[model samples]
Target: MAAERRHAQMNSYSDIELFSLATQFQPANYIELLSTSSVSTLVGCGQLCNQNVKCRTFDYDSYSFMCRLFEGAVETGSLVPSGSSTSLVGAVRFQPNLFAAFGQDCVQCTNSRYLICSSSNNNTCQCPENTIWNGVKCKNQGYEDANCSNNQWCRQDVEYRCNNMTIIKTDLPGNDLMWNTTANFSMCCSWCGNHSDCKAFTWISSPGMSFGMCYLKWSRGGGGTINPGYISAYY
Candidate 1:
């Protein structure tokens, strides 16, 4: 079922076909291009390009798997043989109002009920507060009290307590920055509180693990199930 869902998600992106051999195009503009880690396939590389608002064209290395995304157009006259397996893959441009296809408008997104759109984020639609984007849709965030084992916090409804763990129904949207591996419960809470967008946080500690992993979230939606090693809390 998971594999099926992933395949379906992959199919949702615009198609990109890669060239057979290593090729190079004239360096268009250094200021408009950014390079990042290469994905295993051209499709994966294209998805990355499509997600970024600035990316217009891309070059992928078949051997090293390095992906270079460009914001401007590719010059055909610059195409030459590099003698390596690096190839110029096709590009896929997403809609300006990325959420329009998802049944939302950019103007409506600017209201306090939703997060504002920005060019830096490629104009992607963000889920509203207390809701999570579950790949295809947004859903509500649920909560529950912790079991109170292994130094986990027990919730006290009346009095505010520090370092207490409350289970959130979904994993927050967006990629979580690894705050620190050696941070304690209090430090993790402080880190989340300091960040304006951090709505919730989770800490994972295992017996054999050297350090716990802290995940600060922006959106409060679709973590499917609770793991025994995880302790989640909201601000």
Candidate 2:
């Protein structure tokens, strides 16, 4: 029964270490709390998450026998006390290496074959070969995390632009993150959000500077510019 149930589910994460071990979370703090249900085991809870593309992580509380599915990547801040390290377990969704065939049941790709699913043998997910699973569906490689410059994958409607990079306060400096040639404003934007002192940042595109430039700031500075070559935002 267990194998039959697991045979149809798709998964995102393989490592338990990627999850938050010290703290538990609440629905209000997350970007979106997708769903909740009573489940029998940790694997059962995870299956629910694998079935949903919008779920970034699944929180299973052994003490309560309840599963929580959330949208958006899990973060550490604003955690609620759930007591005992063994009770509430969180699983961060990763990019899957297997795929479900076209018209195959993505929700049913739960079989434990790792990379292959065959319809003839009664497999849950039907795939031509091993590839990448974008949580809910199969996706081609290199396109899992959306490119911020080309398209706002996470926040499509919003983009901050213009300005030279500088801190709002003279006494503080932004985080020590630097720019990498392959990364764009997306990663820089993430750095600012995670930094303790960074309240804002200005990311100059490759054309604007010699390479991508991320100027982390302690606060949003008074600005006046109309350059399409850069992006600025408050963390």
Candidate 3:
């Protein structure tokens, strides 16, 4: 009877491929917490696991109504039965795009790029830095003067322009500011653009200086400091 009930429950997950529903099975590692809600059924638990990119398996506790998501593979000997029955759902397949066939669900690309799953039944990879996704791969977009053309640098509505040797500062003291050292002026612009809160940036370099410093500012107000060693831009 218990087996029949489990089979009925598993059949409801037409989209997922269930591994097992043992009495007390648990996955090896817990990568992240996807979601927790008033889930009381195995199908509900399976749906939660399927929606998360990082979740490979899930364990549902009937008594506490808790859903735990896990990543990685389940070991052979790790499925031990405990006193209570914990439904373990595992191994979902994902079809990212028409070009790529069904593959194991993955949270990220193997090359450390961000995974973008589309609602149009496709999934693609994105490069976070100043890189371009050339359909098949990611390539360096390069820098323009002191500005970077990477999509990750600025928001969709914001535009950043580069100046060779200029600086803009505000009279308002204690404005949120951050500074970091970069290999060159181009990297300084790239670094500043990557930040969501960065409204403007300046790259500073003195005579014979090999490396430059990037200053990220919250505002683009003028009349504060103008120096020959600084190049400023706004986003």
Best by TM-score: 2
- Residue 44's lDDT within candidate 3 is 75
Q: Write the per-residue lDDT of candidate 1 for residues 7-102, one digit (tens) a residue.
A: 113345443434445574333223345667858986677777766644556777768877778654342112446557556545442333333433
Residue 113 of model 3, lDDT score: 16
Better of 1 and 2 by lDDT: 1
Better of 1 and 2 by TM-score: 2
Candidate 1 lands at a TM-score of 0.34
**Per-candidate TM vs. native?**
0.34, 0.41, 0.33
Please report, as a residue range, the 10-residue window in candidate 1 with the lowest summed lDDT. Answer: 1-10
Better of 2 and 3 by TM-score: 2
Task: Give per-model CA RMSD.
Answer: 19.2, 10.6, 16.0
- Give the Cα-based TM-score of candidate 3 against the true structure: 0.33
Q: Please give the range of 10 consecutive residues that has the lowest summed lDDT in model 2.
A: 1-10
The local distance difference test score of each candidate is 0.49, 0.47, 0.47
Residue lDDT tens for model 3, 1-235 = 1221232233332245454445433332111234556688767777776565445446676676777665432331134444555555444433234213122233444432124333343444343333344464333342222233344432243232443324343222234489876644555665665677877777666444445667787876554555555667764
84-160 in candidate 2: lDDT tens per residue? 56445454434443333434554555543333445675544543231244455442221112232233122333233
